[model samples]
Target: MRVKDKIHKLKILRVKAAKAMHADLQHELNAMHVYCHLRGFIGDRDALAFARKWERNIIYSHIIYRSINRSSNA
Candidate 1:
């Protein structure tokens, strides 16, 4: 896997990343709507796991940044 492919797996996307930012969640979830689409089914679920983990990290950082701005203003 290339350094960039690990992020969003655009190779599977139909429109590519140039359009808009959506599906910022698990690729499996985006594909079929399940948080752990391959948690146990696949012995090595690293790719799906990586996508979900990064999605969560991005969400967490956004929340934390907003909280910081709100606190600093108050």
Candidate 2:
């Protein structure tokens, strides 16, 4: 592709990165709600496991999003 096309594509990627970050944040928030609900219903060990799983998901998404943002900025 041409240089201009590459730049344009990068811009689109940046926008997509931002959108993905937002979506992940929303998903994480929803997971938090579920975690809270589960805390009341499930045993402590089960609740803790679910919380850890969701936390890892959120962390992974944020890491990916941050890496993409940083690369796009560079």
Alpha-carbon local distance difference test for all models: 0.44, 0.55
lDDT agreement of model 2 with the native: 0.55
lDDT of 1 by residue, 1-65 (tens): 54355334433332232122343434523542232343332333665556555445555655666
TM-score of each: 0.43, 0.46
- Local accuracy of candidate 2 as per-residue lDDT tens digits, 1-74: 44345335434533453456666566655655564454352455654464555556566768887898899999
- Residue 38 accuracy (lDDT) in model 1: 31
User: What TM-score does candidate 2 reach?
Assistant: 0.46
Which residue pairs of candidate 2 clash?
A: none
Q: How far is candidate 1 from the true structure (C-alpha RMSD, Å)?
A: 7.4
Q: What is the number of residue pairs that collide in model 1?
A: 0
Stretches of candidate 2 exceeding 4 Å from the true structure: 1-20, 23-42
Worst 10 residues of 1 by lDDT: 11-20
Best by lDDT: 2
